[model samples]
Target: MPGNADTLTTIAALKSVSKRYGSVTAVDRLTLEIRRGEILALLGPNGAGKTTSVNLLLGLAGPTDGKAELFGRAPRDVAARRRIGAMLQGAQLGGHARVHEMLALYSGYYLDPLPRMETLRIAGLEGLENRPVVKLSGGQKQRLLFALAICGNPELLFLDEPSAGLDVESRRGLWAAIRRLKEQGRSIVLTTHYLEEADALADRIVVIHCGRVIAQGTPAEIKNTVAQRHIRCVTGLSAVQVKMLPGVTAVNSDGERLDIVATRPEHVLFEMLRLDPALQDLEVTGAKLEEAFLALTDDNREAQAA
Candidate 1:
């Protein structure tokens, strides 16, 4: 659904793209698109070609086959490159550089950049603009990297693990800032291991595995792929007894409480209720993004093996 060529717009795309490193393929005919004014989360486990896909889009790596496009042109096109900003991991921000100064430097690279104060505000670096990069804490430095990335005020952004070093509060603050960017009609390609973050921010999610897309959909749609529901309750029924339920997949219990994963939650709940009339604090929740991710990737792997 991400590359729907109907009425929706596309900002960037990779058409049947492939990348190889010697004998091994890093990306295998991958097709992806960044939709306009949307937060698209590109998700995959470690070494799943996520970095390769981003590199191809950013023109940092040339594809072995097929094509990568930005603004409907070659990824390396100067004008197209200028319209995108990238915030990546392992960037070497010098210890001597101050926050505002670095922002000024990077902003100068673009034809029209965001104001220094605005960049600082968006990055949550306002109070630390004068602090040396080395003296700042890990989280503070992460914020500075984010500030530099947005200084150019690009129409599209590629964020790689943007909230890695942030605490809970700081991470939420950054998420809010990202939402504001989307509100301004800017498109973003976000790659994060935090499934909850993807669930919270992304309008669309693309899951890649073994160098190709395995699943792509909205958060709800993705979660729906896994029919496993979790039911937790305080009950007197033993774990063995609950596992005997017809639809129950697995059951874990700690004395008086039971945590059950089941395909037919209604049947499981009915049986549990009938078995343990004193059951309390019952909660039935849908599958989380992480659960769906694991199931999809594992299924992909199994299919390839077979």
Candidate 2:
């Protein structure tokens, strides 16, 4: 299959890939590609096939149909696998091993791994190198996994919720390290539930739901697809009355505040104020990536139901 014109090189690709287990279809005819020097975020809710897709790409699970490739070669090929590094969810190292020892062990797998000190620094484990894996905190352990993934100095990296157990500070630190990796021209495939992480780091995002991709685009592009404005204010207007207004799709009330989702905020606001002249603290904001995600996924569910 040909690569996308926007990308300079195709590092990995899934061509009409599908994976199934008996009656369950984990991934359904999913076609995706990872480009060189780009961070592509795969996002979806639980049971949405995100992990299945990643497994297919990494050759941990074979596709029931179609193909998965790395560097234009089969993902299972040793050479192809060597070019890729992964930090899968729930992955763990030997509990008795020291952090540095584990990193050294993983480094030996590749012909040219990153320097041990560099990997330790990037993973925020410089001083903790002597600490045993079991002694590390959840956040520290996550950082070590991240360090191990890059230890091989791979051209492509796969991080499945790398910051899952990290605190705010640790998450930011990991983000910085990822940014540095990107600067060094490593392509990355990131599966994360954090929409903000995708918005902040991904060059492109693929949203899958019910084993199929519902949307794929840059963050702004995906958000623009919904084109809804959020209006919130303290108003006496009832949720039912607000929902009946022109261009209003949904409305929710929390105590004294009314939240309105509208395709045309100006029209909705006009109606809202007419009904409740005492409305105060009016705020209108464009649709966030989270809102767009919900709208797109909900639309797909509705379509499938129909």
Candidate 3:
């Protein structure tokens, strides 16, 4: 598959891009690319420069140094961005305008827009088109923003926290719509706070911290980076006894329950059964994306603080 490199023919590229305000650097020499027909997740903590990176791609802000490109052209070039669709963090819709009117207004801006009815159908707002925009719920408004973004049949989509403020059902609906877009071969760049969202939708995940790319890989690849297995078991062994097991790294307890954090889960469990002889419930799961995310970001923060 094509990557974020020049030779790889990515749809979007940031070459050593940086945005600085006096002594503060919002984005620091960042370089990444979103390839054609792939969903790439931009993962980061608060103040991790995720929004700054999106703005650079949208040409909403000029970089202090380096370049932001879309299909080998500058981001600000209207012709280059003609195939792009962008939905920023916060969108404002007219209070009194009907949903259909809002769709019509945005559709007019595009050179070749989808039919208003088709747009509403695609956004799952067919019956609600006559309703006022302000009367729509937060999730509905988000769906409307997504509808407008794709009205032009854009080849590239930029979604910043696209599922924010959406309920579980609305979120699932939006996810299905995104999958349909992907099936049509549209490339997507998504920024989401929900780790599961990224895990489910993104073909590749890129984690940024301290304004730089810290980790980049597939969901499984990122999760495996931690190389730690978590084991939850109901055993009669005490905390101190569990700690003495070979390869058991850390162990804690909550009175009647023992919580063991270890590098070798199998060895810990083996020892527990042999010693206690009455281990009841047991379950093993892989390291969560959130755990790896926190660890990766914390490492970057520590390095910066050092």
Candidate 4:
């Protein structure tokens, strides 16, 4: 479980923050807090205002109403800004510069920057220091961006889809680096479309839809919101019979193997065992993060339509 938001030290916060572009509202009076030493994942589909929320916190855009703060001061304050680092999506450095040169330049911006070799190693770019930015692969470039973000030694880090275009191996490597940063007591705010990334990395997830937060909690808590479970077993029971069982929502069968989806697993399992005492290899699992995400977003759409 994540620490209570009320009791944790808030490194950044949005208080009734609303960002509007004339008639369109990008963020609709949304409030969120990023606490120390936790990875808070901001999840939403395209146009859900995840980017807008991050921009508000980074002071790239002013809110139409309410406030954004960092270290209890206005986000744009120089002293407050120094404590934060960000790797925003679609941002890039000069493609012609060598990796080490770019890092050295960024380091010069901070009074006490991380050593060049240390930044390179942390980003998994140790051997590629002399390579030009344009020559690096997609994953390497992304790692470079990450290195630049942490070079300032900021306490709070914001990563927006940090692994958007990486291959599976690259993505896993990035996850390792993020975990290392977390172990070092640096707080991170991650925004990603990858439900698996959020589920695997975040201490808590904040789901947004149509510019407003629709759900927020630990991974298990969020998954539990949908109230569904999956049960698998090798049994003689037919799919038709399983569907007829109490609390069973859906059922499928592959020869002797039965797959059941239900709102009440215990009730369904009891009824199944009562009918098939020989059932074996029973496996029960809760709703996946992907299912919960789709369900929550779909529910929000229906509510808006109503």
Candidate 5:
């Protein structure tokens, strides 16, 4: 439902926007919108035009065709961007500068900057306030970037791969911070390859492939698109035999184990048990975002090739 006219007044909008680099079309006829207080994750495989789309929204690059607007104004409009914060994938901080000093410098650009200690505390960097940015670990650097992002208390945020280099704990901390931002009723646009991140945080997800938006929906909707449930069982059956069962799409065997992909999991379970009454283990799960993404993008690539 992104880019719908009804949601135009919410946050960001791209109207049939396209961007090109010589012969390569980085973005193609894209139209999407970010809703206020919602986390929208833009996902794609490499070269899917994710970065270009973000740049278009930020007005770092103009669209080759339609328009991209932030709060109904162009992305380059300084006044419109005043209420926005951004953290690019490889954003740099003053390496030798102390954390508090760096925050203070960036805060000067905003109308009402968050208190230095408050920003540091929110980002979980309180103990590292006086430490030089240069000595921070990868996760620490990411937290510093987050601190910089919220220092302005912007209403809209753009985070590009916010958890790329973060360790597990650090990533969880960052996720928590993002949720807090959402609770504050701020809109967020996040881009990351981590499907779990999208599943966990995104209110809706838009999937792009080869510069085009291929799918858009909530995580549950997207997963349901596959219409297949994963059923695992401990049984004595050959993979090919299991695949022949009604409703079964795929079957894999690992010794005495069976993994079945089926359209109707309940029916599949009944049939599996009928096939082998001694079936011991059965686990039914919906299709995951990762599986849907792979299947969708691969199909897109194949279609493009054809």
Candidate 6:
């Protein structure tokens, strides 16, 4: 496919890729592409072949069928690999090296690397240059890993669970950093378990289930896949009573509070008000990303109409 203003150039792609280990198939004919400057969030449940797909894309493992390309070349190509950076899970970053020393050491690997000072600044680790890696907190160490990943001045980055162990503040701070990288025209493949993180940062979300793409779209588009709405309120209505409302799918009650899931929220709310005029704390909202995710992967839910 040709690149246009609206459809950006593809820097990396997995075309009908399938990875099999023994008789078990990890990725089943997965077709994915990474645009030049967009953040593509890869989401899936455990054992969903997310790791295997990433491994194929990064050339850590080869596909049993189809192809994995990096910069239009085989993913393992030396020149192509030079343009990529990755901060994968279970990486061992230890010993007594200081933050600055670590950055300097990683910078030497690439032919063209960002200066150690610049890498530190971009990673929000300027003043902590002298701190030992072992002494850093969970969040600080994560930032250090990010710095190492970017010091190579790579065009593409694979960040797997970048904020896994972070507190709320630290996670948001990392979010800002990721946004900054995107603004710099870096393509990032983010594999994260945090749905909200993907909702907040992804230019597009690709949800995988059973080694295949179950859904892929912009956040709004992905949310629209499910027709359900959420209604929560403190009312005098019982679960049995709310369940009787039109379009209501599920109802949960705790004392005077109730949570309702429905396909037609407007219809349900109208009936709710008529039945319980004293209802307070009433809030009706569209489906959350989490809700859509659950509904999309739900085995009990009928097979996707598409």
Candidate 1: Cα lDDT at 190: 89
On a 0 to 1 TM-score scale, where does candidate 6 land against the true structure? 0.85
- Judged by lDDT relative to the true structure, which candidate is superior, 1 or 2? 2
lDDT of 2 by residue, 61-101 (tens): 99999999999898899999889899999976557889888
TM-score of each: 0.84, 0.88, 0.84, 0.83, 0.85, 0.85
Question: Model 5 misses residue 104 by how many Å?
Answer: 1.2
| lDDT of each residue in 1-306, candidate 5, tens digit only | 335454445678899999999988999999988887789999887778888899999998899999999988989998888888888888876569998888998888788878888888889998998899999987888889988888988889899889888888888988998998887777899997767888899999998887898889998876665467888888876788878888876787777677887767888788878889988877888876567567777667777799
Q: Please give the lDDT score at residue 189 for candidate 1.
A: 93
The clash count for each model shown is: 0, 0, 0, 0, 1, 0
- Which scores better on lDDT, 4 or 5? 4
Candidate 5 regions with alpha-carbon error over 4 angstroms: 1-8, 226-247, 253-258, 274-289, 299-306
Question: Which candidate leads the pack in TM-score?
Answer: 2
RMSD of 1: 3.8
Q: After superposition on all CA atoms, how large is the RMSD of candidate 5? A: 3.7
Candidate 2, position 49, lDDT: 94
Better of 1 and 5 by TM-score: 5
Q: In candidate 2, what residue range of length 10 has the lowest lDDT sum?
A: 1-10
**Every candidate's lDDT:** 0.85, 0.87, 0.81, 0.87, 0.84, 0.85
Q: Please estimate how well model 2 matches the true structure, expressed as its whole-model Cα lDDT.
A: 0.87
Report each candidate's C-alpha RMSD, comma-separated, in the order given: 3.8, 3.5, 3.7, 3.8, 3.7, 3.5
Sorting all predicted structures by lDDT, with the top scorer first, yields 2, 4, 1, 6, 5, 3
